[model samples]
Target: MPSSSVTISSKCTILPDRNSPIIKTTLKLSVSDLPMLSCHYIQKGVLLSSPPLPPDSLIPLLKRSLAATLSFFPPLAGRLSTDAAGHVHIVCNDAGVEFVHAKAKHLFVASILAPGADVPSCFKEFFVFDNTLSYAGHHMPLAGVQVTELADGVFIGCTVNHSVTDGTSFWNFFNTFAEVCRGDKKISKSPHFSRDTVFNSPAVLPLPAGGPSATFAGDEPLRERIFHFSRESILKLKLKANRKRVNTEILGKESNDGWRAVNGANGKANGAVNRTDEISSFQSLCGQLWRSVTRARKLDGSKTTTFRMAVNCRHRLEPRLEPLYFGNAIQSIPTVASIGELLSRDLHWGADRLHQNVVAHDAATVRRGVQDWESNPRLFPLGNFDGASITMGSSPRFPMYDNDFGWGRPLAVRSGKANKFDGKISAFPGRDGGGSVDLEVVLAPETMAGLENDVEFMQYVS
Candidate 1:
């Protein structure tokens, strides 16, 4: 569908509830938040099946509930403030958030959810703040929501500053908004807005006059597709990965016994492997994707490939953080291997590499990463600069389908073209609520074609 298929009807600002006691305050960007200053706003939305209420009533209800929701999330209603020293802080001054009402009568829900159909490019228009950077929050609304009424469904899209909230906080705010829309006066979980508990001393990193440069322009042409893996397929991959590990362990033990017999001694084996460790479903799926993508790209065998996984650090911290802790608290850890080794080895090897990297990012490792960043602040390089890297963001564990908003549950979830680059994959849970997973994969056009035709990858794709 072309962009002209969607037309905006009205645009307005939604402020916090006037009766709420919302005092203006300044929140200094924590170490986790500062890095995302240069990143684009996180744009995600849900596609709900046709609602019982018409647009006349639905739009007003969403707008009213959004105002009520903003009262609890003050920073979202605020603007970014840069101090004289170049430090950035969120100034909660009731600036309000942008809300847009649109109509896409030509589009239907079936066109979007059709099997083997490419995601409509015009979905980007469903969101506000099309290519705006996080720093733009200094002047523009820190967040925005666009509700585009489809012929048979409604698409509620949200654009939030990456510097202000991560996936956890993002969903939390959405869930609260839905709760208010459902006539709930009190939210189940209130956001914890204190950065003091996240770090001991806030690090000061002055920005240049021009602000941070964009690390990823996303100029390269790419193809985005959603690959759905059924529960059976996911279990198959997990079983294969675990079975490979067990067989490898047995082979290693036999080899060690043979070596001991030849040496006529009972010396300990070389490096002991963790026998009880099992590869998780996520890890196994990632491993398969990594190998398949590498093969599809058909890079040189000697070339090095890397998989970057974004790990949430809330529970990894020593003291641990409240589940409702707001803002960014994620670290991207990269697992690297040569193309030859990655393909020559079994799936367990790649999954184990990813599993080990995730396991090694403990509290101490997280602290060291923060300290290193404080020493030299830089924006996240949100792309495959090397042409052989895959960066995974978001998670299947997020409660994506829970945002009912007085309407029925979402039929599907989609994201806008924010921070998108080749090899950038976002995971969402299957709508059926099983062990299934959906990967929103972006790749070079040719590579995507190769992957679509590659039997090894398509065999498990449902």
Candidate 2:
């Protein structure tokens, strides 16, 4: 590689004990690596500071914190290796961390590590690449945490394995490291890494495997797409659904006014929204969106829709389980729908059909199906999902904002690597349980343009 045309001090310092951890095992890595893919339209942000620790000392402090924290996180014993031995080096060079300022609706700064910083040469294969979006995500994470510097700024980016931990777990680790650095009293929440105790069976998804599509088709690199829906538009859609009658006891009867209006405008599919015993707020959203979107395009007569929500089966473990369990203990619950049903009238009442489809997996379904579904060589999921869209995501509820890690609430929570699947939607919290949902809608560029540019949708987006 050409010497960085952008020059900086070549002299770099390796933090203390950088070489201290002995590798119990290592995955052989190839220098030739696939380009890291970034289709996630959202970029979550957090402010990091190690006060009084100047640039020079920052490296040592971070490495020391990582090392000490590892004892508590034994799973990373051999998993977290460096590209170089001894130190997980830091480049103080100008190229090390860069920042850029731009004014949009508000002043914003973007930060990242330089593309080619001197990462440890001894690095293992796991940490160096992108997280695989293939169907059932991997339980093992490639802790390739890098502070990259982009043209505009410096930010921490990595391919965190979704199966190993959820966003809360990921940020939780960071907070603990910070506490360790400050020499705090103790890690507030004890982490669970005992695979046997923390994780239940099948360990993956697609129990029994086969059927549908084959092994995950190569993912089309993610394309940035946004869906514009308004707080009112959402409310309108709901209020018009099931008469003045609603589970409004939670959202209030006024909220369901839109459900009544929409049902009045287009009757038939309006009743289901009122029934609350089945599905969740998030799943209900998927079901509703699937119905609305399908109807929005049904004039063409040839399309289909499926609703899926990231379901946390952690509590579903046999005989019930504890509340503190950590790790990726969820799956995207797929709710099947035919285009005809989704697009037809009274989409609100029809929405419950989605609620009706979910069959939560028990131990039998998991052990016999999930494990075999993932490991079997002959089977995989289907790829030719024409006009099919999925909303695959776990809730961002578990106090992700509470993670101080000695820093503070993250300004944003981002998923750099999304599921390789197309037409995927991710959900995050809306300020303080007013029960808002945000989406990163991935779809073909043109189809998305049609929706985003639509006047009604623009109102929705705002």
Tens digit per residue, CA lDDT, model 1, 237-281: 766766643344554443333211111000011012122366666
lDDT of 2 by residue, 83-145 (tens): 333211111111111111211111123222222122111111112234333111212223434
Tell me, what's the RMSD of every candidate? Answer: 7.9, 11.2
Candidate closest to the true structure, highest lDDT: 1
The pairs that clash in candidate 1 are none
Error of 2 at 212 (Å): 18
Worst 10 residues of 1 by lDDT: 261-270
Judge candidate 2 at residue 410 and give its lDDT: 44
lDDT scores in order: 0.81, 0.39
- Model 2: CA > 4 A from native: 1-54, 57-59, 80-128, 131-141, 149-154, 166-183, 195-222, 225-279, 292-303, 322-328, 358-384, 405-407, 431-434, 453-459
